[model samples]
Target: MQLPGTTLLVIDDDAAIRERVANSLEESGFNVLQAGLAADGLALLGRQRPDLVLCDLQIADMSGFELLRQITELDPDMPVIVSSAAGSMGDVVEALRLGASDYLIKPADAPVIEHAVRRSLDRASLRLENQRIRERLERVNRELELHLKELKDDQAAGRQVQLNMLPASPWNSGEYRLEHRIIPSLYLSGDFVDYFRVSDTQLGFYLADVSGHGASSAFVTVLLKFMTTRLMYEQRKQDVAGPVAFKPSDVLGHINRSLIACKLGKHVTMLGGVIDEAAQTLTYSIGGHLPLPVLFAEGEARYLQGKGRPVGLFDDASYEDHTIDLPPRFSLTLCSDGVLDCLEGTTLREKEQRLPTRVAEAGGEMRRFMERLGLDPSRPMPDDISVLVLSRNPA
Candidate 1:
């Protein structure tokens, strides 16, 4: 079927052939324009910008190839059908190479002419539409790249803030030294630790491993930090007659209650402790934390035996405090579950059994422990890894 106002430009020097072509196309419902000379054809093309062109491949005014080339220079997408004699197969192919859409034999019937023109028009329409789609895709890809860059920048800024929240390391005195480190699986961490002096001869510390990794878990760690500090401050403000303060079990109890009330649907395993220099004792509480704390002294290293319900699990959960007499030359090492991946063992039992020996061999030095385990601080880890250690003696 013929489309409304579809224009066809017929350029042939032979008056009879030109008239026949024009009459056939016009009858087939086209707006037909005729030009005998090359210059006249170009003038009509420049003015009309027709949908298709038909011209002789052997014309007297100019080479048919030159005219075809000129039409392409004017509008590369305009479909052109070249008229050729039956003996001029070479000329037909050459014309096609020069951008002619199709070739019609010299003695073309009306049906053959119409079919060739319609087929070329359909192909040209599809090509132009596909080009439009490709252009739109490139534009959308550029916009998406820009948005991804902005998101990366925002993550970088958030990472710096998380780093600043960590406590300064290597708290030292002549009798004891405390140090800790954390490497997060992502830009933020779910593992958190804090150490401070609670009284003249007592040092307080805790390491909390919130379940999971990344931003959601990181939010819970921040909340844990706030609750710990707030509880400690509350104890300082309480009147002397009111209650005993700075107790490890009471602190974990407060944290468990606070997390339950917030309804974040997150839980944590933690170890909290208070070290007394004058009494030579370490009093600590456990809230389901595992690969438990190791005590190294007197020629042996072993995990401290303790158990309690994990914080944020239930309203009635509780933790128990355990105390150990500090050996003359001893080191206390605490680690989160992420450390389990570093051990070389066929089973978890083998790995758990190797831990105490490794701590004893490291001899209270973090660098030695890391080197032995092949843990490189610069490399990204699979999970959040954290460690806290306190020991006496320099060697």
Candidate 2:
């Protein structure tokens, strides 16, 4: 309705008519541009975006109908009004067919001209607004696509980092063979296993499960690796270079205190052990871990017991170490809670009882055991699953 900032182009061979129309439209708040020929008007239309165009029928180079056809070709939605002194009905009909919005006679009143200009300008404004909206939507779609690509890249990087932190191969210490398996539910895992040589005769290992998945779990696992690696190095130097040997209970207690000091909201469920080849023994502790390890000897299986709370839970929690003398060609297997999910039955203890039988028959093949448990490594697990199998070859 209001033409403020609405641009209008006036084209007429008669300089006086063009000036009169431009002046009136400019005074009425429209931004008016004028041209004396049809060619000049079309050139201006291509260069400057105008809301409406008013053209005289007869021009030196071309007719108003020809200019209207060109304008429609360039932008069909742009409005055009035709004016002429001839006032012939045939010319008016031809102008309308050529896409002119209205036909006006020479010396038309200011009010009538203004009303026609306003209506035509309104149509042009609607067209331009719709065009702008379409462009904005296209830009938004492209941005969303880029954001999704970034997220996928981040996930891949996290998975690579997490995998690099794990042990590349199984550990063998003459008296013990340690093999571990882990399956993550996502690109990053919450489950982790660690092995480090404390001495030529002693080795330390642990399997831990953090609280959640993705970056949070990956971060926690990284911290665990650093702490455990450092602890093993320190303990080895303390024992090999000195007279005293570090006990499993003391190690567990120290880890618990350090985790509480970190003050991370999540806690870790873990089983840790120290194997001494010379003594043919293992000293171990459990921090609220599920499925107590299955010990195999003499072609039979049994469960070893340990006492402790999950790490990061309490600062003063005491741990009790359990000692086991290794028998010739014996095996011990430790697993996370996901093992229980593999069972068809209701309770974890019930499922654990069957694990030893499965391992004994499979000759302690960790992968076979997992398969027999109905775990599909190809599919995403509901929770992190880690398995650590340790065995002593017969002397």
Candidate 3:
């Protein structure tokens, strides 16, 4: 079948052969351009840039082999068929060697000429289509690379923001020392920890594990910070005279309400506490978190008692306050559930059972305890891992 708007050039020294070939191609829906001299054909090829060329082996101005070579040089993909009355094997081989697409005899029938022209045009069309498709794929790949770079840049900035919001590790106040480490599966973490002075006599701290992972969960950690910080500010503003008196349960409840009101569709499992230096006591609360905080004192370790619903899930989810007297020389370790994955156990129950024993092995030193748990930040993890240790009078 003829390609739409197809143009063909015919070159031959014999007027009868050239006109006959041109008439046959024009009848088969091609726009035909005839040239009796090789020079005219080359000039017309450069100007019109026809889809296919029909050239005679011998022409007045130049040999058909020379014209074929020049035509291929102009456009290597251009299709050209050579016609010759000599019909010798030598002439046929020479025409093909010079980049001719097909060979035809001088007295060829109309059907034979049309079939060759259509086949050559079809092959050229396919080559052009493949080139277009290859270019499109390359362009798409370049765009995807640019978008990936932009996403990585955004994650890096978000990670820095999270790092800046964290409390300083190995922070010391009076006889108490606080330290923490977080390992994120991605560039940003869904797990978060914070500790700050609520007043001269009280210190506040919490470790929260937001639902899911990546950017969305990391965003909730920022919200948790803002909610808790704002809650403390409001409570302190109410009374500027004495030490700030607020319960850990109160903080958790405030966060629950704030998160639910914002309709974020996310929740948090957390453990928070306030340490009273004067009273030598730690009042704490839990919000659907596990495997509970472990307290190591005097070569022994035990889990603290607290149970509550996860924050931000329900409107009526209430928190309970639990209090314990502080030991003179002790460390309390708190971790997100991601730590449980690294623990030595096949079951959750088995892991929880072994945690207290692990704490006892570390002997109340924060760094040693982290080593025992294999909490290395540089190693890759499937989920976010966070550990917070609060110690008073190190052993």
Candidate 4:
């Protein structure tokens, strides 16, 4: 079938051959233009922008193969069919390789001429359609690249803000010396630990693991910083009266009530403690946290136990306090659930047993212990890993 709105250009130095080809193509329902030489044919192409071109291999002034190359340079996708009475196989192959759509023998019959013209026109139509599709794809690829770059820049800025919220390291005083390490599995982390001096003799520290990973978990940590800072400021101003100064249980209870009231609904498992060097005691509370605290004293490791529901679970829930006397020289370590992966076990109980040996050998290098536990901070982890180690210098 012939497609409408298609023009055919016939180029031949022989006047009779040009007239015959043009007449045959016009009779077959195609618009036809004639040119007697290659130069004239190029001019016709520029003006008509024909769908297909039929040119003789041997023109009086220019070779059809050279003319085909020129035409392609002008419009790389335009289809051209080579015509010649001298049907050499090499010439046919070379013409096609040089971008000719097909080859035809001269003094041809009507059926042969019509069939070749129709097939060339169809080929030209397909070429034009393919060109259009490729152009569209290039445009889409450019747009997608731009969008990805913008998203990466925004995430980098957000990560910097998150890092700025962390407490300065090596927090030291006469009471205690504290150090913490947090390795996020992504651009942001849900695990956060903070330490602050509540008074000249009392130091408060807490580690919290929010319920998920990535941006949602990171948002929860941000909320924690705000709430914890506010609570510390209020206590300094004597805003709340209590039996024990800087009680871990009371702080957890307050935070729980605030989260419930605000409808944040996100829950966190936390372990928070207050160290009093003057009293020689450590008071702490646990909110469904994992791998419990290990107290290294007298060259023996012991786990601290407490009963408290996780925050955001219930509005009226109460947390219990766990107090242990600090030895003259002792170490306290708290960690998140990511440590469980390093444990060898088919069940939770079995994995919990591995914690003591790892912590005992960790000594003063917490980062080495985390790596030996099969946790990588550079690559994504299955869960967020956080640790806080507090060591009291011998009196």
Q: Which one is best on lDDT?
A: 3
Distance from true location, Cα of 242 in model 2, Å: 7.8
lDDT of each candidate versus the true structure = 0.86, 0.81, 0.91, 0.82
Where does the lowest 10-residue lDDT sum fall in candidate 4? Answer: 236-245
Q: What's the candidate order when arranged by decreasing lDDT?
A: 3, 1, 4, 2
User: Model 2: clashing residue pairs?
Assistant: none
Q: State the RMSD for candidate 1.
A: 4.1
| Candidate 4 lDDT tens digits, 1-395 | 46678788889999998898888778888888899999999999998898888899999878888999999898887888888999999999999899998888888876798898787777777877898999999899898889878877876776787788888776777746788877787778889999887777778899999888877778888888898888878777783433226789888888788777878658889989988767888899988888788887666666888868888779778987888888888778888887676688999988887787677777634666666577666766767778888888755
Candidate no. 2 TM-score: 0.72
TM-score, each model? Answer: 0.79, 0.72, 0.89, 0.82
RMSD per candidate (Å) reads 4.1, 5.5, 2.8, 3.6
**Candidate 3, superposed: residue stretches over 4 Å from native:** 1-3, 83-115
Can you tell me which runs of candidate 4 are displaced by over 4 Å?
A: 13-30, 107-145, 239-245, 253-266, 307-309, 312-318, 363-382
TM-score-based ranking: 3, 4, 1, 2
Clashing pairs in 3: none
* Model 1 stretches with alpha carbons more than 4 Å out: 1-63, 77-83, 86-133, 239-244, 260-265
lDDT, candidate 1, residue 286? 95
Deviation from truth (RMSD, Å), model 4: 3.6
